[model samples]
Target: MTYRTSLTALALTLAGLVAHPSPAVALSSVQWKSCPAYSDEVIRSLRVTEEQVPAFRTLMKRLECGTVSVPLNHRDPGGRKIDIAVTRLAATDGSRRLGAIAVLPGGPGNSGYLDPILRSALRNKEMAGLNERYDIIGFDPRGVGYSTKAACPLSPMGPQEPGTMTKETARKIYDSQVATNQKCGRSDPAFLGQLTTANVAKDLDLVRAALGERTLNLLGFSWGTYLGMVYRSEFPEHTGRAFLDSVAPPWTRLDRHTKDAAAAAERNFGRMATWLARRDELYGLGATARQVREEVARLVGAYDKSPKTFAGLQRPIDGSAVADLAKLNSTEWVRAGKALAELRTTTGTTAPPTVKELLGAPMMGTPVPGAPETLNMTMNLAVACNEDAGRTGFDTAWRAHQRLVTRHPATGRGWGLGVRCAGWPLPVQETTLRRGGGSLVLAGHLHEFMSVYDWTLQTRRAVGGTVYTIADDVHVSATRVPECAADVVRYFDTGRIGSGCAGVALPS
Candidate 1:
């Protein structure tokens, strides 16, 4: 599944001042286990069902994907089996075959199995050096697409509608999420319980053996960075080189990440306002960036005071609304500006365009609404729940809200960390995130809205590797910066890290 950094984690690493790589070796603790071997055809057949074979076969040529069956519980070597989906793009140049570079996509829920196809979106140019030498591989972790999925099936119906969630709604959505987790948890509590990073890293090692590789080079983004770090710690011997982009510190708890994301949203508002001011003619918000920011703040406040009618739904255009919008499409600065301008003019003034019209739902001109939540929420919650086990409950969350609102009035509740898992069903499987063995490279943004910088530092210390700081507002640098990409690619090509990077500052 695709994962992203919490806003808190993003903010702390914005300065782009994190650190460089270190010459570290992979961990030797993990012994390579014997994997049941399968032919290419057999491997391809494993990820699909009898009925899906036709489509799977057709798509395989386009994407060249395959699947492998693993025991549901690793400890119980002989047990009910689950499938792990994999896709690979072989080295275009056979003479340069470097091995395999595994990509761990963010979103504990985002499908990485299809990443080879999506590589054009964020694959580093520096990766070209290893293009012919190594195969780029993406996998769908358990409970995600094409893999043995854990069903928390959500209906397409809207929240206020029969199957969707609404402000007043509860059981339908709650049960869906809870029931999904319970079913997956019950399937093989031993393995499901063991779904921690440490074990997942072990799973990677097995995948490496299955593919007949000596070491695995990795490129991880956001939450994927943590997985890379964990794998580095658990099975350093398997490490070849790793590039961790938009890093989230290992020590960061769910509560802290959420809080920091809210704060970053506030900062984003200012940046967005400035962007809007530059194009005032299209959106007559203000003459200056600061002026435009005030107007935007006023618009958000007005929407909060009274829900606005948009896209046939009475939309509560509050902080959550703003955050969701940002997460859905932060890259399109101009389109978002236009939408904000229109929102200001139409809110409370008239029944604005349908939510679809307002959000440019058709996907031609603008992004589809709820895209971020649809792709991000499940995995975000999973990671948060797993990492922050000691904390739970509405009161605990409400108190956090109290602190956030006091500090950030403009974008507090809406931008603040949400407790969607307050009533989560299954207990978390892991808590502490430690770094050991291998030389891992963790990257962070100085002022990211989702993850905090401090968390990156904690993670760096835990992993004993350098953290690269971006010193910018952009979320994950792996996809955004060529320099960062070069740094990552260099690490993967050889076990060398740039000396320019540094460790997180210690607390006074």
Candidate 2:
């Protein structure tokens, strides 16, 4: 999900995690060993050429890979236990060493064991400099890959395209998901119930104890940002400076968060419309923001009534597809406008082009540098359902979905109906983040989608911290940016935030 890399190796202490092991399970220290095959995608993202692969491989060969045993429930450390997979890259210069920095990734299920690649993948020497001063740590949380996996049948239904989910369709989907929740959640209630964010934070403290370190700094993103906050809250005395990029809201009401995200998406759509309006002479969509929005809505409605066939595509060009594009990442704003313009022509009077000719090429991808990350949808459901306390039933859910769809046309139709937790097996452990740790640096983007920008400000307000506003929409991208990476390294080396620096750039 994130990345890191590096040099001299350290011997595994192989000693007891605590002065003595728990009666139920003996905790082992992280044992450094031979690393697994590096992710092809991660290597590709780093632009690690054939010539560079050999050296890169040699560099990563020094990577420490193993696991640490932690209790399944921190409340009962003497109860059943689970293994937490881990990876570490020792600092190149131990003499000037600061301490360890854990790379906490986004997906509650995102595998982090191979993330040490960002040190070499990123464009600046900042990571290299940061590496010299620290030991980078990566771990797959319990119930994720390499760690004890949380298994269950995935929900039969998922969020659908905008304009396609009618009240009837929503009800059917909700019932199916509720059924999945009961069945899957019942599979392993004891272990699955322990997979909350709070438990992960407890596991991090265990990792710190195993490392024999008094404090551990955090380098987290998206979901990881929330994880860092929780860790800091749980173990403030052990938590050091944290760099949380693309921060999540400190609050835990999943429904409210979902509503805010849908609103943010519509707001971003407006921003894209403004951009297209300025270039109306070229696209012929509209001369102003409001006109462009109306034209897009009309185009979507027409396609909804009757979709047009297109070769080489999996599905026809329909209202659902139209809405998705209209609110895609900013990088795709140009193509989205042209595609809608082409649809507008045909629906209104006569015509459009073979998709590519109208919409142009697909947008660039933002892949993580690790083995292809998978969403243990099983883990996703368990975590989401357990984390969300609102537990919205179908009645309230339908009403909320209708309100969102009617109020926010651009993204509301596609937003989740928010009823999955209604029949969840585990009791909700709503966590209210309590600030206690060292200095924290929060980074946010202006045109974000999944983890909206507002959450950043909300998080800062929740827990006092310095904030950095990124102009681009890419999630968790600060370390990938040259200036932002420097700022991040500076913060870790000496707690200081960046000025109004540039973020990921949009296409020219």
Candidate 3:
């Protein structure tokens, strides 16, 4: 049977099972225990240091940690089981407590288990209200964080090197990516095919059952929005109030979604240029936004011809690097402009201090010594590849890249969507998500590059909900905008969200 047909059959089977209650069978309750100990190396991989362990432990004192056993393949509940790591902060006011609220962080790979500590350290006060009446739950999805991890070899070509628009360069990158994925498959042959969003949603349902909650509230960001949608679709009867922040469109194809992301980045770049040009006296890049954009393009061309080397960075900063940096949101435009200006002033010997510091910092591809390969990146590949049923071969990927470069030259190459899952050794299981009859509050920022505002509208329409748009450049609305955060908190408390795009706070 086709993937969609199987999904339909599964949905019907699940509905029938639910309709005909089976009193004989019950899901096993979670065996709560003290959180498992992690080595210093593992702790560091989570970006928590040895010095912070005492505080983290102290924080954990007030919460509970455990693992939920879930089937490796949800299609067969009697199949091999895997452990999903979970953390819970019980509601302070149990008298008024609502059900559990599962926090799903973005990156398909990001650890939700660490979100509580990270939020505490960042002083995120917006969710303080919800914390009073809801048990805030976080978990590492299967094959991520403290969960059973899936390891893979790094690409042999090293971190994606800046590419020239040549067939040879594209071919080399594609082969390297494929080899890297193949290596991951070899490393964890049994689990790679199971690390999909649909399976993750199934694992989530198991978590809810173990918590003894019949329903759950969902708070999802970026890729998490997609997960939330899937959860609502499969288990709509078990869904409570949902707050989807920085929504991602329901696109099954990775290439198309990435192309849309590149276009959005280009639009965001335009906004940044306009903002910089208005402050021309301070930045001195250009008097008009158009001139500023043209100047940026010119600089990219000049740097492409001859890359600049800094004192601290191992690799030289090239045109591609500049273009990539330019795609940053409006908040970072000033820094980007400063870096550009410093590059323009290079006399082939002296490097500006700011430029040196910026270039010296570890970028996306920078490999840290002794650091474990992140579960986020690994699972991202697994999930994206598992869901994508469209063309992922070298030729198709090359054409996508070419189209991106031609249409959105400023940010296309930097998007890095090409050849991501070209050699993923997994069968596609496309999810046929149906809109659940649940009230949802979707939120987005006007300037979000990755999850653009259009995605919010599309998702809102798909799920039938009110959208709370923030007139700001922040990526995730709830974290940055107070009003947006208030809406989320209010929605959780009362099943309604106040509408208005008033408060626009710029990121610090």
- Model 3 alpha-carbon miss at residue 280, Å: 2.0
Per residue, candidate 3 scores C-alpha lDDT tens digits across 294-372 of 7877777677677766666766777677777778776666677787677766686556765665666665655455443
Ranking by lDDT: 2, 3, 1
Candidate 2's residue-wise lDDT over 1-508, tens digit each? 0011111110111112112212333445876556777665566655666566666676677788888888876656776778888888888889999998998977777777666655422335676667778888888888887888766865445434434567888888788878777777666666777777887888888888888788999999888899999888878899999988888988777788878888888888898888889989877878999988887777767776777665544346666677777767776776777777666665432235535554333433445755444445666677777788688889899999889878876556555678867677556666767878999888888888778888888898888888888888777778877888888888899888764467877665
- For all predicted structures, in order, the TM-scores are 0.71, 0.86, 0.87
Residue 272: error of model 3 in Å?
0.8
Decide which is better by TM-score, 1 or 2: 2
TM-score, model 1 to reference: 0.71
Local error of candidate 1 at 135, Å? 2.0
Per-residue lDDT tens digits of candidate 1, residues 3-84? 1434354333222211112223232222222222333454333333455455444434545556666654555445566667
Clashes (backbone N, CA, C under 3 Å), per candidate, total 68, 7, 1
| Stretches of model 2 off by over 4 angstroms after superposition | 1-27, 38-56, 119-124, 158-163, 345-373
Model 3 gets an lDDT of 0.72
Error of 3 at 116 (Å): 3.3
Candidate 1 minimal-lDDT segment of 10 residues: 14-23
Q: Provide the lDDT at 462 for model 3.
A: 73
Local distance difference test, per candidate?
0.56, 0.74, 0.72
